[model samples]
Target: MLGARAWLGRVLLLPRAGEETRMAQSPAPIPCQPTTCSSSMGHKDWMDKCVCLLTAFSEHMRRVPVALPEMVHAFSAQQQTLKQIVICGDRQAKDTKALVRCVHSVYIPNKVLILADGDPLSFLSCQLPFLSTLRRLEDQATAYVCENQACSMPITDPCELRKLLHP
Candidate 1:
């Protein structure tokens, strides 16, 4: 999603080690050399240089330049406003199917929706890092909406789910 101007700036600002070495020797500009071209280099040398460049670029783009805690803090900050919905039930139950269908019909931006048929506790703990505690499903089909570490009352009906989502 980089703009053309930003991309051009990166291309221009990229440090050229060969250019730097040549510049330090003399003030006069040197003619372009074919030996500097990748096509003119040996296949093994070209491949090695390509790998080095890719590794350096990827390292530069990583969010954590130093430590794991910094990366976790950055990720948490990015997800602070995220809203989550968990639909829990037996997978083959009619009520669970109805709830899934109802949920799919609605669209909410930045909302993380999970359909859990197995152990709800394990699923919630793994997917939702901000939730300290999760309530167990009481019915054959149920749903919960959580935001800012707070959860709404468990809903058992699909119609109630639609209302809660739209409201």
Candidate 2:
């Protein structure tokens, strides 16, 4: 009985060569330049694309277990020559872990902005008690734009998000 149990354990513990190889290998993603806006495009068209791209990226990051690695692999595969990539956020400091994950995955080439949402003044004054702490945490990045916990710059002008992405 003991011999049989030992045999069973060995069989269960054995790693298939093919499975091991596959597990060791990572998937490559379609890479693009770091943060170059797709040029020769109109503002309306650009905005549309930007929204779509951002939405897709956000969704993927939210869902995938190893989202950062996949994003990095994709970016590297594309050899994306980026000047910078801005990440617009609500600036709760709650998402700092996710931000750190992003930092680990991508090599910060130029700048990465973690922008806040909504109106900056109220969020800074009323809600965020550790505003200075939040800013300091973001000091690790290229810049941290605050606007009501939303992005103050990139999408500030309403259409800039769209324009920057497409046009």
Candidate 3:
């Protein structure tokens, strides 16, 4: 794994500080907007941070911006396990069930599509618990996809969500 300093540097971009005071005085690094971590932190760190951040956001939905708790709760309540994901709006892809269900395609808006495939790099980046719960189920062995918490899978067409769920 890359060193934290390198990772932090790449993420923050500001020069290293000579003192702890400087570190504290520095403004909280704005959430890495534009998802530039791909270029600086390299692919692994970028993906890890994405998952970690999304996961944290999902776990703490009330504190994060643009998160939907009800959606997350509903997703978690489902007894079915998911494998794939399909992202739509800025907060659309935040579902975990899709990833677990091995969803084949995602319909993402231009605004939220960040990674090379318009998918969140990590499950931790999820701000919604539904997505977070699904992500928590994901591992090297299972395929998963998400954005915020709304997730479903067993789909072949981007416009075929109607086939997957009763919504």
Q: Is candidate 1 or candidate 3 better by TM-score?
A: 1
lDDT of each: 0.51, 0.35, 0.34
Cand. 3 TM to true fold: 0.23
Top candidate on TM-score is 1
Winner on TM-score (1 vs 2) = 1
Cα RMSDs, all models: 18.6, 18.3, 14.7
TM-score of 2: 0.22
Provide the TM-score for each candidate, comma-separated.
0.45, 0.22, 0.23
Q: Put down candidate 3 lDDT per residue, 1-167, tens digits, no spaces.
A: 12222234245533234423332433222224313334221245554554455455554455442334332432332212322243332232434334323233443221122122224555433522233233222221222243233434423333344344323
lDDT string for model 2 (1-167, tens) is 12111111112222233434322332212112211222111123433443444446655555553435535543443343333233334455444345434444554443334343434475532444323233322333222333223433322222333334333
Name the better of 2 and 3 by lDDT. 2
Residue 88 displacement (Å), model 1: 1.4
lDDT per residue (tens digit) for residues 103-128 in model 1: 78887644666666556367554544
